[model samples]
Structure formats: C-alpha cells, structure tokens
Target chain A: MSRASNHQALLAFLDTIRRPDVAAIDLGEHENLVDSGLIDSLAVLQIVLFLETEFGISFAATGVDPGRLYTVSSILDLIDEFG
Target chain B: MFVNLDVGVLHEPLSGRRWEPARLRLEVERRAAHYRQQQLAPGDRVFIGYGNCLEFFADLLSVWQLGATAVPVDARLTPFEIETLVRVARPRLFLHQGELEPSLAPIFEACNVSPLDTDAVPQSEAQVPVSSFTLDDDALILFTSGTTGDPKGVVHTHRSLRARWIALQQALGLESYRRTLCLLPTHFGHGLICNCLYPWLSGQELFILPPFSPQVIMRLGALIDEHEITFMSSVPSVWRLALKTARAPQKGSLKRIACGSAPLTAHLWEQIQAWGGTSEVLNTYGITETGSWVAGTTGGPFEAEDGLIGEPWGAVVAIMKSDDTAIPPGYGEPCATGETGFVWLNTPALMKGYLNRDDLTARAVSQGWFMTGDLGYLDAQGRLHLRGRTREEINKGGMKVYPADIDAVVERFAATRDMCCFGFDDPLYGQNVGVALVLEDTSADTLRELHAWMKHHLAAHQLPVKWYLLDAIPRTSRGKINRDSVAEACAAHEPVDLANMLGAGR
Candidate 1:
C-alpha cells in the first residue's frame, strides 16, 4: 500500500483505540505517540496486535526494537520495512 | 551499626557499561554533598521527578543522607498533575533530570530547581557533615493512586521504614547473595520498600529495569540468566503478561517470587510456578498505609479461597464490623471467623499519617489499628481472605455483592483475558453491578456464550446489570484496576437493560 493509505489506516486504528472524542487529533508525521498522550505502555500492546492483524505482519518473527514503535513515523517506517 | 549498601542499575536501551558498586556509592555521597552545598538542610522536602535511573537513586540517597524528606513523583504523570502535587508537598527543592515541560516551569519558580546529572562528578570543597536524625524523623512521602478518591500523600518516617524492612526480613528471611530483579516504578511503596530498600538493606544486588511493558518484560529470562536473579516481586498484572510473552526460566537461580498489589488468581499462580521454575511462589498482601507487604503465603500455592492473603508477617490483623466494632478474638465469634468485614491492621510499619490531611488521618487510624478499607474475613485457620473494597461493593437493594466473587467466577472463562466488576449508582437498587471485560474474542457469538456461562455461575443480584467490552482494562501505574473509574466509564455509556442481561431477577 501507498504511504497515504498506510497513514489513513493507522490513524483509523488509533482513533478507534484512543478516547472516543479524540477522533480529531492532528497528526504530525514524526510526532511521538506517548509524549502526545495518545497512547501508553498498555496501548502499545494493543497497537502491536492491531499492526499484526491489520497489516499481516508479525513483529515476533522479525524482531523489532520496542522503542522504534513509539512514534508515528517510525511505526510507518517499520511497516514499510517489514510489511 | 552503619550499613553500607551496594547499588547498581541496568540502564535502559542496554548501554553495555559496567557499573562498580563501590564507585557508585562514592558518586552518590558526592552528590549528597553537592545538595548540601545548595542549602538543602535536614527536614526539608525535596521533590524528584526522574524516572527509574541511577540519578533517581542517587538523588533519593542524597535527600535521606541529609535527613530530608524525598517526594518521588511518577515520571509518567502530566505536568499539571506534577505541579498540583508539588504545590501540595510545598517542597523546598525540586531536583529533576530531564527537561521540564513549559507548563510546569511556573510551578517550580518559588522552589530551587536543580538539574541532576548522574554522570557529573561531584565537586565540593567544604566537608559536609552528615545530619544526625532521630528514628522518628520523616524520610519519604508517596502519593496514593487516587483510584477511588483524591490522592493523598502517605508519609513514612525513618523508624517506620526500618521497621518495614525488619518485618520483611523476619517473614521472608532475605539475605545477601540473592540478586533481585525490579521492574516496578520506585515511587510506589511496593517498588521502593519491598523491591529496592529490602534487598539493599539485606546487602543484595538489584538489577533495576526501566518502566515495564509486555515487550520489555519478555526479555526477563535473559536478564535473570545474566544477573543470576534469585528473588523477584511485582504486581499480578505484570506476571500475567510475563506468563504470556516471556520465555521460560533457563536456570534454577530464581528462588522466591512474590505477587502483591492485587489478588493473584489460582490459575495464574500455578502458571507462574511452572514457568518460573521455582516452588516458592508467594501471594502477598499489603497497602501503602501498612508499609510494603504485611502478609504473604509461603511454602506452596494458596489452597484456601481465591482471595486468601495468608498469615501476617510481624503485624497484627483483625476484622471489624462496618460500625468500627472489633470482632472478638475467638474461633466462633459472631464477626470473627468466616465472616466478611473491614480488614484492620496494627503495625509499627504503619505510616505517620496522610500529609497535611489531619481529618483523613484521624478517620483512617483509630485507637491503634489502621482501617484498611478492605472488606475481608479471617477463616477458621485465621488466614485472611479479601472480598473487595468497601466502596466498590455492590449494594443491590439490601443484599451486598462482592466484586471479587464475580471476578473469580468470570476469570474461569477461557475467552476472558481480563475482567473488572464494580458497582454503579442506581436509583432502583441504590447501587447496581457492572462488569468490564477485556476478552480474547470480541465476536457476538463468543460474548453470548460467555454471558450465558456467567448467568449460570452468578446469582440474581450478583449478576452484572451492564457489560462493557474494552480493548484493555485501565489500570494504575502499579497495575491496580481502578474499579471506580471502570464503573464511571460504564455509567457514561447508554444504560443496558438489566432484564435482558439477567432475565427477571427477584
């Protein structure tokens, strides 16, 4: 999938998981999800599950740095590299 | 007797730097001198906001060495929250490691703000004499999670801290040569007293990990192998995640593992024993008010009721009615054996009081016993079994419903990953039951099947009037699910039909 489509899919999943009224969160490509209070340690686990199921990619099989999954840009980069 | 404790840190992101304990101690002392040079006198309160790092430990020791109080805030807390706490604490010095948010700068304007760098060599010309403090001098202040209500600062004196360490030593027989692996945040009593202070006082080494995620804790096996970690303690939620993600034990170095902060289920306890490769898995019980852990199950798995918290450790446990009347100390008293009521504890390790909240302190402590606000009972064998929190208990009309009983029953469902049951305000019954579930399968058929199974297991008044399917059950930093928050969240949603969920309750 293209970068735009990937961003759209990611945003949709995040919006679903985050607080209900937080649907209009403005996304900078390189913004940190945790620092912005959009997610937390537990939410990261849910995101990993969402990535695996939605993108058909397994993070366990291909080891990824947990820190790299903390930002929007890095997560998209991970999808490009592994997907 | 002066005890020189050895401290070490496993820096996050795996910096392959070797840490010498003796060198670290000297560095900490130097930092203490630096703080003293900055006019931080004895009995002053110092607020620290650094995460789990060597600098956090150094700053803590520095404050204690000066006979000052250390108030450690959770690094994950918002700047507003931190500012609020700092205002309440009214600390003289605000020592932080990283950059403070712009919002919090105004809050620290009155206090002296100092940037703490662990790697910075301590430079001081004058010889700073260590302040002599009595055992009753206040040492540390930890804020509660504020799950049910507003967070209050729980204060502990040097004497109370030492007493807590002694109680744990008597109960667990902790000693040197046993390295401990700590993943919990040091700000909380469980992490500070039980994991760090107890081990360090016993002259054992600590392998401190950064804030835990399931991904980070999955690497526990490797750390245990490298550090030869023998003793470990964490809340029940982390253990549940570890059982799912972590690799099994590689060696028999793990000796004693304890789970506290929340009740441990029998299934999870058995899994931890099998995967941990240790026979001495203990289910502990305590709160911040009573120091760290006051009671723990040793020798084997809890063979009694699901919430059995085992015997007391160097403390006295008693059961009292709602009206503050103590149950007579006998086998067959009306409120003594096999009857649920408020759990009361009297111990030397109890907190001095809630900071600046004299009314709450007076209400919490009466005579000599600290009211735990926990609903529980003593069995015929005198072992304690926790029901639930007094505030979280569902009063359906006149009959009372305990959430722990429902949680125990619902956790048996294979599809239920995690569950929380709480009480919501209802005009009809005064209070009604609500259940929030983090399920493995969210399909309609699976939920239908689970609900059907739940109906068969729970009684009419005990059945949850509303059900919420959640991605994850919201928990505090210490892994405790705030039942009040869950109930409020359920109340926010469109009300569910109780008759439809639990057909025609009497």
Candidate 2:
C-alpha cells in the first residue's frame, strides 16, 4: 500500500483505540495523543500492539522508544522505518 | 529499628531534596510550629492537597505532632468531587505545596476551610509544638473511593498504623527496604502505609517521586541504578509499561520487589522478576481497611503462579463459606482445602473504621475479623490465592473506582433517565470504566451537555471511556442492577462514538 493508504489505516486504528471525546481525524498528525487527552497514557500499549501486529514491527527482545508512539507523525515514522 | 521513633532520611528523587534525620526532625518541628500558629488543635482535621514529595511527609508528621488528623487527597479530583469529600472530611485547614484549584475557591469559602501554603513557615524561631498525640488519636484518613458522592474515607489511628509497621518489620525485615523507591500515590494505604511508610518510619531511606510519571517509568532502570534502590513496589499496569519500554536494571542492588494494589498474573510476575533482576517479587494482597499489606508471598521459595499469593503477614487468613458479617468470623463452615470463598483477615493492623461511618465500619468488622471483599482460597500449603472481587468497584490500573460513584453523578444529570456503570477489561489498565445510560434523548447536543456535566463533576480517571446508549438499564426482577450482565450486553455492541457524533472530524 502507498503511504497515504497506510496513514489512513493508522488513523482508523487510532479511532478504535483513542479516548471517547477525540476523533482520530480531528487530531493533528504531530499532536501528542496522551498530552492532548486524546488517549490514555497506558493506552499507548494499544498502539504498540497495533504496530507489532499490523506492520510486523517487533519490539520483543529490544524495546522500541516510547516516544516513537507518542504522536501520529512519530508513529508513522516508526512504521516507515520498521514496516 | 521498628520500635524507634526516628525515621530515615527523606529524598525527592526528582527535585534532589534530601533531609537527614536531624534535618527532618527540625523540619517537622518547624512545620509543627507553623501549624500551632494557625491554631491547629488536637482532633482537628487537616487536608493535604499535594503528595509524593519531601514537604508532604513533613506536613503529615507536623499534623500528627499537633495531634491533628491528616487527610491526603488525590490532587486530580474535580472541584465538585473535592467539595463532596471536604463536606464529609470537615477539615479545619487545607495544606498545599502547589496552586490551589481556582474553581475550589468558592467552595472553600462556603465550607469555612482555609488553604495554607506549606512553604509559608514562620520566620522567627517559633516554639516547636509538643507532640501530644495519643496512640488512640486518628493519624491518617485515606479516601479510598466514592469521590463523586458518598465518600468512604478509611480512618487509621496511630496505634493501628504502628501495629502495621511493627507487623511488617516482623514479617518482611527492613534490610531489603534500606533504600526504597515509591512510584505510587501517597493518598492510599498501599502506597502510604506499606510501600512508603513501613520502611521509611523504620529508619530506611525513601526516594519519592510523582506517582507513575511516564518520564520516570520510561527511564526506571537508570533511576534505580542512580539511587541504588534496594526495593520497590508497583502494580502490574506499571510493570506492563516498564517491561515494554524501559530497560531492565542491570545492577544487582535490588534484593526484593513487590506488586500489589491489583492482581499480578504469573506472566507479569515473571516479567517483573526478570526486569528488576530479583526473584523475590511478591504478589501482595491488601485492602484499605486493613492498613494494607496484610498478606503476601513472604514465607518461602515458590514459583510464580497466576493468582498465587503465598501467605499472611501479621494477620490470620481464614476462608469461610459464610460472608455474613453479623455472625462470628469462625461461626461458619471453613472452605474445604482449596475451595474459594470469602476471605477474612484478623489483624491488629485493621483500620479503626471508616471516618464518621459507623454503619460501614459495622458491616466490615466483626469480632476483630475484617471481611475482605475478595474471593480467595487458602490452599493445602495454607497460602492465600486470590480468585476475584465481589465488590462493584472497577480496578482501573490499581486505582479503585466504584460504579455507584459514577452512577450517582450521572443519575443527577438532567438528561439522564437511568444509568449503570461497570468495569470492562482493558489491555492497559486491568479494567477501565464503562457506562450504560438511558438518556431522555439520543441527540448529540444532549450527549455533549452530559459530557460537560460529567467532566465538571468527575475526575479524569473516573470519566467513562466507553459509553453505551440504551433504551433501559437492564435490571433483575428484584429491581437491582446486575453490572456483570449489563457489561456483557455492552460488549455485544459497539460503544457510541462521541467524537464523531459531536463532529470533531476534520
């Protein structure tokens, strides 16, 4: 899939996982999900699970930087590097 | 070391504040002097507005020195929730180290409660207030749940607290806890009494930090290595993050570790053991009423098993078929060797009772055996193994939030016709709050208004993350909410998309 399609897929997954008051499409690409109250601090784990299962990004033996999953832009960067 | 009144040096790991025994005593005395200037008398209640710092401990000690009861509140509580608690707590003064919530200004005035700054100490050499508090004097009041309304503050006297400290010393020695780190909040018994106090008051160094700050949990390995921490305790939810994101501590300085305030699965238990480089990870079982840390894996060597809590510490654990508090704790058929039943604990560390709540105290305590709402069994080896909880409280990342509390607030909303709150399992928090509401209208405007009302009344953690709009809240023929059934129904349907309905899309 192209980068646009991948981004759309990421947004859809985030919609299923974020806090009830914020929409994935409304959130900025560079916005911090947790700091902006769009998602819970622990909810970042869901993002990790998503990246690992959907994009085949493995963080088992050596953990990925949590900052990579803090924002949509950073998470997309991580996906490009790993996926 | 357990009997001594002298406490160890206090350290703020983040701020780099250290107070030696002598300096700590002076600070406590200075704060006590300051409190006396404010006419803080014996038996009066003082609310602590901030926690997890050096000043908090000093203020608590000073409050005790003046024979006043110290009530520590979760700083995240909404002003409405705080007002409800303050109405019940009836504190004479509110001591804070941070900016008081501006919204609470009116409530404080109406309640006749003064907010005092912890740093506003007397300049001149004010005489230190004499420590006149008796053993029977109330020492601490931890508001466990019911913040939205019916506040249930667990009140512990100095005697009961000392009983817990002495019991911990006898059961789990103080060597491993020589340099302890507390990443949990100080408002609750598990964190204040067992994790932080049990050792620090026994003359062991304590390194305190903001509870569960991601920055700290992210670099937990380096934090431990830098402080040479020997012991620490946290919930499985926190370990979940550290095990995935943070590097494991390489130093062999850690002697013991504990996971409590929530269930510890064998999977997470092993991961915690590996991450901390310690095999002594204990799955501790405790409740707010029992001064916390009543039982745990303390006795002998054992493999990590799911729901396996080894033995009682400073308490007698009993499993009985009858849960009736009116009957004597022993006046029932004991559960056969491995049969799960109501867990009862007879311990000297039990709280005096809920603050100003004799009815609640009566229901929980009978003949010195406090009924733990947990369903656990005593194995053939006489170890305590937990099964589940019977209470209608949601354990969100180890912070217990009651369903009734949320329901109380939602039911009061003008648009809400009926409401029921329940716990749903989550990958992050072991369980998160979810609600089923029967509103007058299903319009987006009504939901938005209800959302604003909920945000004003409820704490951030107490807000329902998953919402379900229903025609009616399911009830049994007896006219009572069966939360389990309602939650199961919610699971069969997708939760309402508040963001999409409210047009938050670009």
In terms of lDDT, the best-performing candidate is: 2
* lDDT tens digits by residue: candidate 1, A1-83: 99789988998777654532123468687887777766545566556666767787674323456677777788888789877
CAPRI rating of model 1: incorrect
Off by over 4 Å in 2: A1-6, A13-45, A58-60, A64-67, A81-83, B1-5, B122-126, B503-506
Residue B409 lDDT in candidate 1: 66
What DockQ does each candidate score versus the true complex, computed on alpha carbons? 0.09, 0.38
- Candidate 1: Cα lDDT at B55: 65
- For candidate 1 chain B, the 10 contiguous residues with the lowest summed lDDT are B497-506
lDDT of 1 at B21: 67
**Which has the greatest TM-score?**
2
Give the per-residue Cα lDDT of candidate 2 at B430: 79
What are the lDDT scores of the predictions, listed in order? 0.70, 0.86
- Compared with the true structure, what per-residue lDDT tens digits does model 1 show for residues B1-506? 13234554333334444345664566567877877777878888988876566667767876887888998877666554566577677787777764556766666775445445434535653244476677888989998733112447899998888888888887788643268877877887888888877876566667677755555666666667777788888776566545544566688899988877766667777777887787677778878888878887753445534787888887888887753424322322336588897788889999999988888788788766788888888887778888877544565542345677678768888899998999876533346788998889876556667767765555444667578877778888999888988777666666433333332221
True lDDT of residue A5, candidate 2: 81
Candidate 1 chain A TM-score vs. reference chain A: 0.86
